[model samples]
Target: MTKESLKELILTLEKIQLVLIQEGEQEWVYGISSIKRRLTDINIDSPDFKKEFKSVQLSYLNMTNGAGSFSDVMIWRSNVEDRIKVNKDFNALTKKTWELFEL
Candidate 1:
């Protein structure tokens, strides 16, 4: 997503957080704070960043290397259901964790 889009998502989440708090669901306040921090930390103007960002999405494959792993395959390799596989495979674990939270 673009910076503007990320900002919009963060704003929406912030509103949700307020509602949650008023409803005594303070557990989600930290989630909203985390989202705001993460969205603001991104550099959406860089071409390479945008390219990589789009690459590993659940709908796009990773093509920077010769190996073409489909987006669904990529997601399967990194999502919560595959946490054990990720932990056992050191090669993509770091990237997976980063992608899981960032993308």
Candidate 2:
């Protein structure tokens, strides 16, 4: 991908990320659902999925309220989301936790 193409793709990914996050937060669905949907759309099951995911990794800094260092919020959050995708047992644990919470 040319630099311009990469920039465009990154912008698209950012939009996808935002939409996924909003859907997850608004509907109380797991964010991973949106992530999965978006990833799949980008041919995430293809042989190049892993490479593509890593190539366009996003990063940003954020500050909350008074007097704090600029924290790497977007990267941290993405890493967490990525972790939830990577850890094979996380979904099962999340389901069980939700079930217990609902009970």
Candidate 3:
């Protein structure tokens, strides 16, 4: 993907994180699934992307288990934080990957 596309993806991810924080875990399910779909569309072969995407997917699955308790909220928050961190790392990696093509 182009750098602009990668930046857009990261921006979308940050928006999702904000939605999760404001609207709760139930609202986050759709956002996470959408992100997973976007990841699939990129079709990149990087192990880091796959690994980070898997982490986000698993955390999303755990958050959507219908528990609906305080602990579940905490877990969901933690998962969102993890996703944000992973997305930041992925953004950096994507920039570097694209830079290599310019050389």
The residue pairs in collision within model 3 are: none
Cα lDDT tens digits, model 3, 10-89, are 56555555545564556555655565455545535564665655555455445445677222333222588786775565
The order of the candidates by TM-score, greatest first, is 1, 3, 2
Best by TM-score: 1
Give the per-residue Cα lDDT of candidate 1 at 25: 51
Candidate 1's TM-score: 0.41
| Clashing pairs for predicted structure model 1, backbone only | none
**Lowest lDDT 10-residue stretch of candidate 2:** 56-65
Candidate with better TM-score, 2 vs 3: 3
Better of 1 and 3 by TM-score: 1
Model 1: per-residue Cα lDDT over 4-63, one tens digit each: 655655565455455445545544456445554555565778667665444433222222
In model 1, how large is the Cα lDDT of residue 27? 48
Tell me the tens digit of each residue's lDDT in model 2 across 1-103: 3444434544543453454365343332333344334443655346876565543232111111234322212222357767555333433433332232221
Candidate 1 ranges beyond 4 A from true positions = 47-103
At residue 47, what lDDT does model 3 achieve?
Answer: 47
The lDDT per prediction is 0.46, 0.38, 0.50
Backbone Cα, N, C clashes tallied per candidate: 0, 0, 0
lDDT of 2 at 28: 23
Provide C-alpha RMSD values for all models, in order: 13.2, 14.8, 13.6
Error of 2 at 91 (Å): 25
Q: The CA-based lDDT of model 3 is what?
A: 0.50
